[model samples]
Target: MTEKSMLVVSAHSADFVWRAGGAIALHKKNGYRVKVVCLSFGERGESAKLWRKGPDMTIEKVKAARREEALAAAENLGAECEFFDLGDYPLRVSDEALLRLVDVYRDVQPAFVLSHSQKDPYNFDHPLAMHVAQEARIIAQAEGHNPGQKIVGAPPVYAFEPHQTEQCEWIPNTFLDITEVWDVKRRAIECMAGQEHLWEYYTRVAQQRGVQAKRNIGITVKRDIQYAEGYMRLTPAVVGDLS
Candidate 1:
């Protein structure tokens, strides 16, 4: 069993599953703890998938459905999920709110923190989430620079891929093999009925990533699998004597 747990900081409800469902499922199957912090209920730019199902869908109804989908997806991946109820679209974060996010990091005290990349040119919330997550990660250490930060160890942080981010030079500093857990990833993605339309596309994204990884020698990776995930480290992960 993997001893370390991971905290996933997402801009919206479905972003986590879309980017790292394979990784999340891989961790869970290895007995690692997984927690998701959704910065928003995906009220604005992201809720269209649900609201479009019925023209009369109210804001409250759409939110409720999205939450259910998030929970179901997390359950499918064997991880605990929580929604922060933060504002969507124009993601505004106050110092107080960011500190609350710090509290989550301290409370969870995860060894690994995964979040959205900061370079998403198209999505406003994605960059905001990245900022909050980056601050929370640094603050979690409670170093001398920021006395207002929550007291916790500085966990290793990584950024997951996004749609626009793929073309924006995402150099993965770390890689985790998710071949065995690919099926779990597929199932977790299937839980998002509202966004079911994009599931296959995401699956293909993973497969493409796997193919890219195959070029590296001395790492025997099977080509039959059709799913993979990638991440770039925000800070170095001191695992052992890699140097």
Candidate 2:
């Protein structure tokens, strides 16, 4: 049988680490081949600390640092990562870039896809990333987009948690219990040195999500969930049974 795979489309280098790190680590532990596509290094907008490192900080330098951090995080989570090098702080995805993402969809043939929320008032780039991710999925399923290449199936799409769930209007319909891989996720989260301030915040988010996940699973399940990742599933779940 073919190995299962999952794809994560991130607007910035560290987005994947903060939002879906638990999912990445847990799914990898479950034998899924994980792939992360970072649309940009978030040099201008997200790298505030790197910029404060004196007057000699350049965009290239910041980007390099972000790249290293993202790579380390992906490595810790056992996932392969690809960088688009597209500048952030108003991420622009050209027709060429969109097609490139389509190619990734065909190549990975992901069992499911993860990306940002559809709406983020604080970060416009976040919504744009999700827009492109869904657009690419549609194009990848089109036989005429790249004739003769294998087309991808109808893989479910999920929007990972945003920083401000209420503001972004993102509600989690799916919760993944990531207690077993919480340590691995934390290790990956630590790799993001530039965003140290958010480390504890996301950790708390995981703990809160875990409580919600446990409540949803009921008290009779007898499973202890200490950490979890929330996702707003964008597509319908086609299941054989409703159990």
Candidate 3:
């Protein structure tokens, strides 16, 4: 049997941990190999705690710290993490970087893809990441685009929740019940020491999503869901059965 796999394209090193740690952990527990690609280390924009430590903190130092944290977080969730090191004050994705991402899609042949929301006015990087992810997915699916490499399967793309869901205009069409793996997710969250302030915020987000999941499924099931992650499906799902 072929092994199941997932690909997550995050704009920042710690974005995956914040948004999809539960999903990653749950999928890993279910026998899926998860691969995370962080387009940028978020050293410039997201490393407030590290920057606060010293006035002369170099970009390399910030990158190193964030990379270490990201690796630790990925480890806690049983996923492999890779860095693009694209740099991020305004997170730009060059043509080379886009091609590299397309290469990853072909190589991994992911069963599904996760990425940032298409609209995030507060953080421009999030939207740009989504754009690149979508383009890469398209290019990867075209057989003629890269003649030597095998064309990838058409995997559904899911946009994980942003920090400010209301401002981002994100709607959750998929709610993942991650109650069993909440501990794994929390451990992953704790790994991101630079962003300690967000720990409680994400935990609460999970709990609220769990409540939404419970309501969406109805009250008759008697589920005691304590944590969950929500996603917006960006592609049409092809299913064998309606149920």
Measured by TM-score, the strongest candidate is 2
For model 2, state the Cα shift of residue 111 in Å.
Answer: 0.2
Name the lDDT value of residue 105 in candidate 2. Answer: 94
| Candidate 2 to truth, TM | 0.99
- List, residue by residue over 92-143, the lDDT tens digit for candidate 3: 8899999999999988889999999999989999999999999999999887
Best by lDDT: 2
Better of 1 and 3 by lDDT: 3
lDDT of 2: 0.96
In candidate 2, which residue pairs get closer than 3 Å at backbone N, Cα or C atoms, i.e. clash?
A: none
- Model 1, residue pairs in steric clash: none
Q: What is the lDDT of residue 121 in candidate 2?
A: 98
Candidate 1: tens digits of C-alpha lDDT, residues 1-243: 526778999888889999988888988887788889998878777876777777788878878988998898899898889888877887788888888887788777787888888777778788789889888777777666356644667777788887865665677766556788888878878878887778888888787777666654235644554456778887765676774
In candidate 1, position 142 carries an lDDT of 64
| Residue pairs of candidate 3 with colliding backbone atoms | none
In model 2, where do residues sit more than 4 Å from their true spots? none
lDDT of 2 by residue, 1-243 (tens): 899999999999999999999989988999999999999999999999999999999999999999999999999999999999889988999999999999999999999999999999999999999999999999999989869999999999999999999999999999999999999999999999999999999999999999999999999999999999999999998899999
Question: Positional deviation of 143 in candidate 2, in angstroms?
Answer: 1.1
TM-scores of the candidates are 0.88, 0.99, 0.97
Q: What is the lDDT of candidate 1?
A: 0.79
lDDT of model 2 at position 33: 94
- Every candidate's lDDT: 0.79, 0.96, 0.93
